[model samples]
Target: MTAVKIIKVLGTSEESWEDAAQAAVEEASQTVDDIHGVEVEDWTANVEGGAITSYKATVEIAFPVHESSGDA
Candidate 1:
């Protein structure tokens, strides 16, 4: 049987929200494999000196769960 797992991740960037979202995916890819898709759940930002300092993205990452083969 094949299964998919979804997890929420937060990414931050000093640029645009798009970049923040991409950052999330990239970071997740470092640990997770076979990433099929991502959904941006929310968007947020931080303000410093009355200006937008950074962007934050809340994303849901989806990947297939690999079953371990009976090799041991």
Candidate 2:
């Protein structure tokens, strides 16, 4: 059996929506393992001087939960 978990995270980038989503997954991987997939829930932007200064992405990261040795 496989156990999974989902976490919501926010990431921003000056590049594009893809970069923002990638950044979120990269940052999460620093502390998380077995990353399965990412679902982009929402997108927004920071506007400055009639231009988009930054792109923001809200993602749901999914990963497998490892079982402890003591599990019965």
> Candidate 1 lDDT, tens digit per residue, 34-71?
99999999999999999999999999999999988979
lDDT of 2 by residue, 12-31 (tens): 99999999999999999999
As a whole number from 0 to 100, the lDDT of residue 20 in candidate 2 is 98
Candidate 2 clashing pairs, residues 3+ apart or interchain: none
**Candidate 1 residue-wise lDDT at 56:** 98
**Model 1, runs deviating above 4 Å:** none
Clashes of 1: 0
Name the top lDDT candidate. Answer: 1
TM per prediction: 0.93, 0.92
Query: Could you give me the TM-score of model 1 versus the true structure?
Result: 0.93
